[model samples]
Target: MIKENPLVVSVGECGLDYNRNFSTKKQQRYAFREQVKLACELQMPLFLHEREAHKDLLEILDDVTAENLTLPPIVVHCFTGTEEEALTYISRGYFIGFTGTICKRDRGAHLRDLLPKIPLERIMIETDAPFMNFKKGRKSSEPIDVVDVARKIGQVLAIPFEEVAGTTFKTTSSFFRLD
Candidate 1:
């Protein structure tokens, strides 16, 4: 569908997720590599997902990018990895997307610790809507909750919310080639 349609903005929310065993590791790797191939073929940005499979995911991406310099941009969506892991991806020149999980008091500590190390230009914030209910009282999250994501990032990075908003907007826009 993406290959046939010009309206398809990016190539995926495709990658490996071992946390829930939704699919076997082999199946995930095959699917992920195939999608990366499609993204490379189409020259569209990638919207990626990764859980406990960073090492394998990185290896696959490395292999894909090794033979092709024209591959589209890649964003590791809803990243919740450690500082070292995040730094590894950053060093490889990929963007990292954050979600409302960073707003949660209990779960966000590690993310907060690592946020400062990520360059503002590479940060992309998301809602992970209908899933991440970051607020204590809210039943579900919506797209508007991206503001809260930025707010939490601002708080952690000790920067103004507006600056976070502006930088993330530019980062996402540029990554997606929205301009």
Candidate 2:
């Protein structure tokens, strides 16, 4: 198991994906629960993948907290959920990872609006390579595209580009610490 591997830094690619439903809801729920427990038990961070399942996701996390389990630091990767959902996750002390979705003026408008609601400290930026095409309709996003994400964030929040880049870099580094 990855938990036994010293090189493992976080438990992930885990969470509910209702949009595709590639995995049955039962299977996803069970796996998500187990992974959350494993991460909590191991004191490791979580890199989650969620799409159109915010309600269920929050319920599950709340259940774990009800059980007195201390959740590890969690970053909802490529977060493009609703403003309410984003606020809910923020309230739970979970971090939000922004992808190129915010670059889409129309589609990303809500996220831009919610950005002001989220504390900068709880923010992280990602390229979501081979997944997000945030680079002006390129084949797919690459690590270099992270600059675009940072730039959009700076533009929306009215913060300087350098500060956005430096803060997110620091936040990500601290969240996924080894040991």
Candidate 3:
């Protein structure tokens, strides 16, 4: 199906969701593994979605890595993990995507502070459309809403909003090797 869709740049938007565990662990595992393999076989980058299943997710990656699977680069989209988790993935050369949800007053604010600690080159911005709405009083999000993410990240890093947008845009384009 992806081969038939030239516009699809990713093989995933897939991973475990332990937060809700909407699917059984075994089921999530199966889907996650299949998607990982598909991403590798297709030579397409993965848009990874991980929730409270970090341990399981990392374990799967380790297994795949041990098998010498040539997986394309991955981005942990709409990341809401701890700084330690973020650093762990960063150390392994995965890009971290931030969303407008990071602008919230609670944990999101902590991630905001953590952002400046991350190398600018290792970052990307996403909206995770139809979810993670951060606009004041808004209840949903859209891809175009990623601009808010860019702006918030700019505030966190003390950089101009356009600079953040341009830099992250370049970083994402380069990471995916997109034109």
What residue runs in model 2 are displaced by over 4 Å at the alpha carbon? Answer: 1-6
Q: lDDT (0-100) at residue 38 of candidate 3?
A: 81
Name the 10 consecutive residues with the lowest summed lDDT in model 3: 1-10
Expressed as tens digits, the lDDT of each residue in 5-71 for candidate 2 is 8688888979999999998999999999998988888889989989999988888888987899999
TM-score of each: 0.93, 0.93, 0.93
Model 3 lDDT tens row, 1-179: 77668688787789999899899999999889888988887889988989988889989888777788887899998899888889888988899999877878885977987787789888998887787887777789878988888888888888999998888989989777777
Q: Write the per-residue lDDT of candidate 1 for residues 1-179, one digit (tens) a residue.
A: 56667567898889999998788899999998989988898889989999999999988888887877456888999998888999998998899999999988879889988888889889999988988788778889999999999998888888899999999999887777777
- The local distance difference test score of each candidate is 0.88, 0.88, 0.86
**1 or 3, greater by TM-score:** 1
- lDDT, residue 161, candidate 3: 97
User: RMSD of each candidate?
Assistant: 1.6, 1.7, 1.5
Question: By lDDT, is 2 or 3 better?
Answer: 2
lDDT of 1 at 97: 94
In model 2, state the lDDT of residue 19. 92
Q: Report the number of clashing residue pairs per model.
A: 0, 0, 0
